[model samples]
Target: MKKIIITLSIALSFALPSYAFADQAACEAKAVSKDGKPLYGAAKDASIKKCMGDAKPNDCEAKAVSKDGKPLYGAAKTASIKKCEGGK
Candidate 1:
């Protein structure tokens, strides 16, 4: 039982970091502009940062609303969330 527990713990330790790295790579691959161009400098940094789960979770999503209190949709919501996440 002790050997099984130790083996399982070791497996989980390796699995967790690889999973995080895979997510990070996916985020980096997605760091591009709307025009299909790759982002550079601060933009790329911000994209990766947000994608790697550095953003304020649902705070920005909840704030995505129009002045008239209507929920923002599509590009507007995306832009709003990006801005709230400290991106350009």
Candidate 2:
């Protein structure tokens, strides 16, 4: 049992950092304006905040797909969609 717990803990430590970095990248990518210009200062912050807040499940469908081309389901799907949508 201890080994299993330690293994799971180690796996999660590696897994979580990737998700965090991915989310930061997504937020930065979404912080741009529709006119192809990058926002700055409070505007950039606001844009990132809005983009994350307005994220929807459908918005992340493409990113939420499984390796076999099937849509993900349940919590995994939800987390994937949220991550893709730039939500924390």
Candidate 3:
């Protein structure tokens, strides 16, 4: 039991840092990558482009959909469509 406990503790030490350091709130704001993988922890809008292959933030749109792949603004890509979507 002593050896088992030590082994588990060592494993948790290695794994916990990566898991504990992530901020869940920031990750929710930005949608996942093109391949449908959630980006790590809630990052600023610009961070959406980083850690997911280092693309320029401005190069991509803020996704017409939410992180869960729901159409936020329908098929509309224009300001008018956005206004309707936002119920403005």
TM-scores of the candidates in the order shown: 0.59, 0.49, 0.27
Q: lDDT of candidate 1?
A: 0.91
**Per-residue alpha-carbon lDDT of candidate 1 for residues 1-88, written as tens digits (9 for 90 to 100):** 9999999999999999999999988998999999999999999989998788775749889999999999999999999999988884
- Estimate the lDDT of model 2: 0.81
As for candidate 2, its clashing pairs are none
| Reference-based TM-score, model 2 | 0.49
Q: Give the C-alpha miss distance for residue 53 in model 1, angstroms.
A: 2.2
| Candidate 1 root-mean-square deviation in Å | 8.5
> Order of candidates by TM-score, top first?
1, 2, 3
On residues 1-88, what C-alpha lDDT tens digit does candidate 3 reach at each position? 9999999999999988777446433444455667777655554444644433343333333554466776555355455344433432
TM value for model 3? 0.27
Off by over 4 Å in 2: 54-88
Which one wins by TM-score: 2 or 3?
Answer: 2
Expressed as tens digits, the lDDT of each residue in 1-88 for candidate 2 is 9999999999999999998778777997878778988889999888776755656666687679888988889998988877887675
Q: Which numbered prediction scores highest in lDDT against the true structure?
A: 1
